[model samples]
Target: MTLYLLIYFIIIMGAVVAVISKKLINSAIMLALLSIGVSILLFAYNAPWAAVFELSVCAGLITVLFVSAVSLVKHDEENIKENRVKYVLLPLLLIGFIISASIIVPEYFSKLQIFSTYNTQKEEPIGKLIWLYRGVDIIGQLTLLASSVFVIKHIFFKRKEADNGGKI
Candidate 1:
């Protein structure tokens, strides 16, 4: 609806402005807010699964990564002026792509309501839906988490001890 579109536009503009601002930490927080906006739009469009995925993966995981990176690198108080446009360009493009796909792809998937709306009985709970229908996706997510941990340990945490010849 028009109301949804208006709200989406406002949230997106807020995201862009936040990314363009001078603070890196603020930009990361805004990126999380932008992900929440996408989640809202997903839920509004009747894709609760996609909404949960966005909230868990993009908003949760990526924001944690940003915060870890920020903490690892101490904040500098110096105001280093750079081109503001560079920071927001990629995120803006990604948002535009997502918005376009959300609008256009639905036309092809108009008949998908048949599959999405299927429920065997009222006895089934949400966890049953997740485990029965989406178990493989959950396993894949765990694999990704394991891989991320491997990367952090090998790349970020590993340190080599120095060796020097004693004979001079």
Candidate 2:
């Protein structure tokens, strides 16, 4: 219960920071944090498949895409004014969350039946289950990944061309 509350707090704070952040990179990082918190919550709820997918696609892939896009944009960091207090607080908050989670998560998982070592019946292998039962989801995730990569490539090339006065 306490762990769930803490996770919820992290998710909410991350979302608020992501929306209000002035820098694109900060927003992207916050979005990743938010996704990670949600993933942890999903895992605690015994939804491992959903948790993994959320962590991989949202936290991993989308955050990479966001950071890549932000890197492509030209920005003069020296001129942008930022609040130092929030920057300092962010790390402290993360550290506290990590420490608390480490202590609580193991105990929480021990109570879950899914994480238990003993099973009455043998279960299907994870690989076979995913491929056979969730084939369409796998295909969709792959397609989304491919399409996002091409879109980013196109945007980068277009920006370069525009910068070069329409020369590719």
Candidate maximizing lDDT:
2
lDDT of 2 by residue, 60-110 (tens): 999998998788773764466777677657667877998999999988887
- TM for every model, in the order presented, reads 0.57, 0.54
Per-residue alpha-carbon lDDT of candidate 1 for residues 1-168, written as tens digits (9 for 90 to 100)? 896987688677767766676766777788888888888888888889889999999899999988777666645524466765787586868779989998888876886765696667676567897799878999998999899899978776634454334422
True-structure lDDT of candidate 1 = 0.78
Compute the lDDT of residue 83 as modeled in candidate 1.
68
Regions more than 4 Å wrong, model 1:
76-81, 84-143, 158-168
Candidates' lDDT values, in order?
0.78, 0.87
In model 1, how large is the Cα lDDT of residue 40? 85
Show the lowest summed lDDT stretch of 10 residues, model 1. Answer: 159-168
The CA root-mean-square deviation of candidate 2, after full C-alpha superposition on the true structure, stands at: 9.4
